[model samples]
Target: MACKVQKRVSLRRRLHILRFLTNSNYNKLKVALENVKREYENLIATRRDYIRLLDNNVNDNKDVKIVKISEGTFMVKVTCEKGGGKLVAILEAFEEICVNVEEAKVSCENEFSMEAIIVSEDQSLDVTYVTEVILKAIEK
Candidate 1:
């Protein structure tokens, strides 16, 4: 009888240990999940702030939109009320700024509309500067 009782005690102890381990692992996973959620929220907030800054800088001009796609790449879109040699002028301006046109889609049938992927070696180039240069090209 004593042997049987000792065996029961051992089994009970093992069950308790398993339950404790399971609860510990559950707590750890919960904490990790919370940390990931916090990090995601922070990343989203940072992106929102960056977009707001870009909007403020480019809001004055409705004819042009310039967005930085990556470190040295920009996406530029321009729409003009008139179409002529504006496309050539814009290309020249891009050359003057040392920017290369990686890809572009342009329509100069009735009005001028262009979407271009531009890459630049100059790290200091920003949306405002590119916008100004394109605007000047459109005027000329």
Candidate 2:
């Protein structure tokens, strides 16, 4: 009878130990799961912000729209998100490219827009070549 009681007590102690270990493992898994969840949330928030900036067309800086007004005259339109360097470079683009500035209008603000009517100073002014030079200056 005493042997039976001892065996039962031993089995009960073993079962209690298994339950404790299981609970400890469960708690550790819960904490790890929580950490993963937090990291996932942070990643999602950062991605959302990036997508928002992309959607706003913030990457549309230094975009150019040009139209050939005549054989030696061309209309150049440039858009910039920030900085006055591009604006200053554009004024110098005509001199650098050896072209005449017929007319130019610039508005300095959040999204600056510059519209210019550029003409060739001499017969050397090629429409395609001058357009490329102006576009490159808009990048600066």
Candidate 3:
């Protein structure tokens, strides 16, 4: 009976040590994964900042334009156009301007007018700036 009790106590201690080791290893892995994620996010932010700086320096006229023709009616545009051909070209332009656009109702005319209803989440200057950019892009 004494021997059996001693064996059981030994087994319990071994199991406790094993569990502690496993939990410690798991916690380390979790920390490593979190660090990796933070590093990845930092890299992405750096790349984005670099691209923003490049675009600003290279393209002098690239802007978000807005115009208010009347009360409760406005037009907006951005200068981030890409892709191939004219339709694609216009679409790319629209996309470039839309990076900062939160919500908008858009209508495009291949030869005429491109009208849109824009709702911006945050604004530094005014909503009319968005409209001006859109008009300029469409005219181009």
Candidate 4:
């Protein structure tokens, strides 16, 4: 009958519309995902550059390690060769900027290590300044 044909066509049309909407939503989600990935990649690249600059600036005469123990706190630990007095002075200067050695121990004659915690009181201290301090300390 004609009525039966009309009902079938209407159902078919509804199903087609539903499929189109689903495809559109899927495309939108895909685009959003790509945008997020790109932004994340950019952030990672920037962080890498900043870290590279810091590492290069730091004195490499010995083995100096800086690790972030928390979100806003960092620990600078250094183990240097004999006569590392210059590096010590540089670290001491950090005290003026509120960087303090929470624990420092110097052994008999083979090793010396200090755990200095750097926490910015104003959250405005740039890592560049910290890098400069490290470089200056190692300057010959």
> Using TM-score as the measure, which candidate wins?
2
Question: How many clashes in candidate 1?
Answer: 0
The lDDT per prediction is 0.89, 0.80, 0.56, 0.67
Stronger candidate by TM-score (2 vs 3): 2
What candidate 4 gets wrong by more than 4 Å, as runs, is 60-140
Q: Where is model 3 more than 4 Å wrong at Cα? A: 61-140
RMSD of 2: 5.7
lDDT, candidate 4, at 98: 67
| Clash count for each candidate, listed in order shown | 0, 0, 24, 0
Residues 63-111 of candidate 2: C-alpha lDDT, one tens digit per residue: 7777777777878887767674777777787887677778989887767
lDDT comparing candidate 3 with the true structure: 0.56
- So what's the TM-score on candidate 3? 0.41
Report the C-alpha lDDT of model 3 over 1-140, residue by residue, as the tens digit: 99999999999999999999999999999999999999999999999999999787744544455575344344554443332232444455556654333344433332222334443333443554544544455446
User: Which stretch of 10 consecutive residues in model 2 shows the poorest summed lDDT?
Assistant: 122-131
Which residue pairs show backbone clashes in model 1? none
- Sliding window of 10 residues with minimal summed lDDT for model 1: 53-62
Question: Stretches of candidate 2 above 4 Å error?
Answer: 1-36, 39-60
lDDT of 1 by residue, 1-140 (tens): 99999999999999999999999999999999999999999999999999999776544333999999998799999987654588899999999999999999998675678999999999888999999999988887
TM for every model, in the order presented, reads 0.54, 0.59, 0.41, 0.43
